[model samples]
Target: MKTSTVLIVILALAVVALVARLFFFSKSTSSAASAVMENLMTRTSIRAYQDRPVEDEKVEQLLRAAMAAPTAGNRQPWKFVVIKDKQTLKAISGHFNTMKMAEHAPLAIVVCGDMDNTYPADGRDYWVEDTSAATENLLLAAHALGLGAVWCGIYPMQERVAYLKDLLGLPENIVPLNVVPVGYPAENPKPKDKWKPANIHYEKWNGGDSAVR
Candidate 1:
């Protein structure tokens, strides 16, 4: 073959290889991304709890599952204050924006992140994110066990956090993330579909409709 003809043949083969690589890479990425979205969408939050008290063994299992969640750098900076006391539960309920369910919940698990344990000498606090993950795991585990749970915010609310600290005798290093009130669900709340077509963007932020499957 002439040199010019040989060059054209080589370039054509290179283009075919590049196209094949791009197609497979795109398919693999799309499959992995879809799996992640499905897992996230299946996890739902519950609030209406039944009068049944969670067993000690079950509580321990739930806590173990919660602590198993991934942490930033595996710092494991979170701590939990489990409240089964009725009077204490009532007191904490008073601080909540909505307190109707506090009277009925069998127990409350106060999720706290230790800022002291999370610090890496950079003066940055990763405790909030770490503890949030732990709290979500706790809630998910509760739901999986046929229990109901509600996440009531506490940390950033200075007054509520201070009250909980004083009530629970929490150390200065510990920052309360939220109180998860848990029990067997008294009401089975229907899960709402929060999927919005316009909220999803493909490859770029074109504000196009979500490609709902």
Candidate 2:
């Protein structure tokens, strides 16, 4: 074969290989992205659960995910109390009206923020954001692990805070943020379509009188 013809054939083969690699890479990326989106969109607040218990392995994975959340300055000031005792679960459910579903849950996880582990001065309150991020991660992890869970708020409500602190024997430095009940789901509710284009502002607020819903 001619040297020029050989060079042309080699370049053509290289281009074909590059195109194939790009095509597969794009497809893989798209599929992975779609899966993550689907998980986020399909996750709903599961209030009802089955009598079945969540496995210990899944519980650890949930906590692992929670701790993997981003924190301010890497403070990671979150604390978790895993509750599997029936009496404690019942007591929590008995106290909070909105959290009655917790009584029947196979497990409950209390998300807390350790004030002692927070940032200094004005940034101290950043613990709330840090723990809240952890809580969201926990919820998402539960969904991904095929377990149902719900976030029952506790912080800011002094009465609830006091009750949980006393019940769980939490120290003064540890502030409870929320209690999450986890188990096999008994109800399959549709995810809410919370997207509102009017709520979005590009670069700057388009000043419009829209009351917060």
Candidate 3:
């Protein structure tokens, strides 16, 4: 074949290969992104719990997942107090009326943000954010593990916070953020899709698709 014809064929083949690569890469990336979004969307918080208890090993696994969450500057400034003690759990549950659901939970986890452990030399505060991330991880991990969990706020509520502080003998630097009740779910609830396209902006704040509004 002529050299010109040969070169033209080679260039065509290269163009085809490039297009195929781009097409496959785009599909793979889209699939991965969709999977991640689905996982986040499907995760739900459970309120009603069964009488069944969570196994020690499963609880440990959940905690491990919680601690594995990313923290600001990799500073894991969080401590978890696992309350399996029946009396202690009952007492803790009494502090918050909204947390009565915890009464049926076989195990409860008290997530505390430890400023003493999380503070940088500059005295910047990262405890709240770090502890929040940890809490989210715990909740998501619990749902993924076929366990029901609910986050009952505590830190911001002065009465509940003080009660937990006094009851647990927590130091000044340790602040209780939330009490999570974990156990088998007695109720099956589906998660809602809270995605509002209007809330999302692409590139700039071009106001997402009007259909979303």
For each candidate in turn, give its C-alpha RMSD to the true structure in angstroms. 9.5, 2.8, 5.6
Instruction: Write candidate 3's Cα lDDT for 50-163 as tens digits.
Output: 888799889998899889988878889999989988887888777678888777789899999887787687644677778888888888888868898888899788888899
Please report the candidate that would top TM-score against the real structure.
Answer: 2
Which ranges in model 3 have alpha carbons more than 4 Å from their true place?
1-38, 121-123, 203-213
- The residue-level lDDT of candidate 2 at 173 comes to 96
* Candidate 3's TM-score: 0.77
Clashing pairs counted in every model: 4, 0, 0
TM of each candidate vs. truth: 0.74, 0.91, 0.77
Better of 2 and 3 by TM-score: 2
TM-score, model 2 to reference: 0.91
Best by lDDT: 2
- Per residue, candidate 1 scores C-alpha lDDT tens digits across 128-175 of 888888888887777767787888888798988898899999999888
**Cα lDDT tens digits for candidate 2, 1-213:** 999999999999999999999999999999999989999999989999999989999999999999999998898999999999999999999999999999999999999999988988999999999999999999998998998899899998999999999999999999999999999999999999998766765655658643444
Residue 68, candidate 1: alpha-carbon lDDT: 90
